[model samples]
Target: MSLLPHLHRLPSRVILASASPRKRELLSSLLSPLPALVKGINLEIIPSTFAENLSKDGKTAAAYARLTASAKGKEVFDRCCGEKDKAVLVISADTVVESPAGDVLEKPSNKQHATSMMQQLSGEWHAVHTGVCLMLQSSSGNMIETTFSTTTKVRFAQLSPEVIDAYTDTVEPYDKAGGYGIQTAGLGGSLVEEISGCYFNVVGFPIRSFVQALIELLDKVKDKDDS
Candidate 1:
């Protein structure tokens, strides 16, 4: 009666095209009761040249997230289709924090960079945007990609220089976007004041939206097979 039993009967395998441990953990929750239903594939995270233009008009945080996720999915789909695995499903995602000043804070490179990012986020409200893409390879070897994005309004508490420096010394901020991990030490729930949207989105993945999308995708494939 579990979802995994049904998913196992599908025609293709589900592959997560990301190297992020956070993503791997989140996706694992989706493929539950079916051991190893999701496999992680390390795909390059570089966006295409076209993706850079997605925010040319300075769109909302949600728009930018969706666009980035779609781009990453397409990139991975192109690479996977070239192989013999014609009926594979690839999931890709990207997360970014948009500062009030309109700058996108990505993963920081070092302690100094992380400290600077934390300082900018201190005592302010910022937007967390996460874009998720689902790419499925058809029987005809055609790849179809669908994308969606989620936005969470996060408000951080005012941090003294000592607090920022203390948090930076921990490992929790280095591997996450905007140099902070919301689920753990990223100040989302513990130190953050408020959030306006999906809680999981700030943690890294939007669980509700992601599950709904997966179900819809599977239904489409089922209908096609029935025909």
Candidate 2:
């Protein structure tokens, strides 16, 4: 079933709680392909300032991703609640890279940090985890929340120190997790020889999993509506 029918019935807008261009572009692309499903649906881009202060501790990588995504979603959802008009649906997500040895890697702080991350990833396998959260409030004030995480395993092609240093100098790794972006047209994609799961997950959002979650979320409320 398509989310359009359900989404169209509600007098609400979809808000994405992120400022990253990649995320905004991806979200727009995801919805654009289904024009009939999302036509006339208001799209709001609201970036959240929620600090990612969640420490590693004993929490697993997926757990951390979900925690951060939930926090971000709630942060934005609360902000939208102040409005008096239509309902709101807020979407949020967080991504991280986990080493074969189980260490979680977030965005590198500096060039040196990115250099270290590349060194650890050279010729090794790492898992990318993305947590996604969807919170929706109907026009009548009914609310629903859904959360999930997806994992993708990526194997790096053996990279030399020179390559890592040169790539870091290009200024792409600092803002991305694991000090690299899987979508880098040349520099980044060349480093990973293969990946095991959803390709989009490594790009910071799991498109396939997200679609399924949305359907299930709407389906639940859909059932209630039918009853």
Which residue window of length 10 is worst by lDDT in model 1?
Answer: 40-49
What's the CA RMSD of model 1 in angstroms? 4.4
Q: Cα lDDT for residue 84, model 2?
A: 61
Model 2 lDDT-worst window of ten: 1-10
User: Clash number for every model?
Assistant: 0, 0
lDDT of 1 by residue, 1-227 (tens): 23443455344566666667777777676565444555423323323333434553666766777777777767766765445876777787878898767678777878899899888889899989898988776565555557888788998888889888888787767778788877774353456878899888887888788877766776776566566
Best by lDDT: 2
Q: Residue 83 lDDT in model 1? A: 55
As a TM-score, model 2 comes out at 0.91
TM-score against native, each model: 0.78, 0.91
Error at 174, model 2, angstroms:
1.0
